[model samples]
Target: MIKVYGITTCGSVKKALSFFKAKVIPYSFVDLKTTQISEETLEEWLSKQPLLRLFNTKGTKFKTLNLSKELSDEAKKEWLLKEQLLFKRPIVECEDGALLVGFDEELYLRTFSS
Candidate 1:
């Protein structure tokens, strides 16, 4: 089963979930608003994906926080830990230990299509 982490109200998260449901893919959703992801888990994801990919720079949360775009990797990671909304929407953890951040229709099709 795929593990998807993000808030439900996010448009990208909604798209990802809809795609999964449409494809009949089995996935478990972890709402970031209700659940907190640990630093260890975030680090694991960061190892698989670039920090910029996992960290959402364009989101309203980022803008609202008035964070500097030139933040160092460590600073970014610290901010991510401090705010769950700073994460890119719909981070998917595949059974093969692959991590995907955000929704891309083509990527989802190629990866999840049976």
Candidate 2:
């Protein structure tokens, strides 16, 4: 099953949920607010996609926390674990071991159309 990780109120996350629903694709929503992502799980995602893709450097949380893009990979991971909002939003872990981050309608259509 596909597990989508993100907050309910985030626009991108909402779009992702809507996209799945509209496409009739099965998915389980995991709210980041209540869910604490483990280091292992994060490592898996990082292996698939770069940390910059998953990390939200423009989000309020990042600005509030004063995060820098120059941060090392390890430091980025630590920040991600400590502050969930630093995530880009809607990190979808597909059963095929694919990690989809953020909302991209064209990509989603191509991915789920199969």
Candidate 3:
């Protein structure tokens, strides 16, 4: 099963959910605000995706925290653990163990469409 992680109120997450629903694809949602993401899970995602891809640099959370000034990769990882909202919306953990961050309709169709 695909496991989607993000806040329910996020527009991106909503779009992802709608896409899956429209396609009749099953998925489980883990709300970041309600459920804490583990370091192990984050590490697994980072193994597949670049740290920059996982980081929501354009987000209000990043701007509010002023993370762009100067921060090492280690520091950024630490901040990600401390602030789950700093992650991009709709992080999808596929049944095939692929981790996808953010929403791209073409990518989703190519990846998950039967």
Q: Whole-model Cα lDDT per candidate?
A: 0.93, 0.92, 0.90
lDDT of 1: 0.93
lDDT by residue for model 2 over 1-114, one digit each (tens)?
999999999999999999999888899999899989999989889999999999999888999997787999889999999988899988999889899999999998888898
Best by lDDT: 1
Ten-residue stretch with the least lDDT total in model 3: 65-74
TM-score for all predictions? Answer: 0.97, 0.96, 0.95
Which residue pairs show backbone clashes in model 2?
Answer: none
lDDT per residue for candidate 3 within 12-64, as digits (tens), equals: 89999999999999999998987887899889999999988998888889999
Residue 76 of model 1, lDDT score: 96
Per-candidate count of clashing residue pairs (backbone under 3 Å): 0, 0, 0
Instruction: Between candidates 1 and 2, name the one with more favorable TM-score.
Output: 1
Candidate structures ordered by lDDT, highest first: 1, 2, 3
Candidate 1 least-lDDT 10 residues: 105-114
**Taking the tens digit of each residue's C-alpha lDDT, what string does model 1 give over 7-72?**
989999999999989988999999998888899998899889999999999999999999999999
Error of 2 at 41 (Å): 0.4
Q: How many backbone clashes does candidate 2 have?
A: 0
- Is 2 or 3 the stronger prediction by TM-score? 2
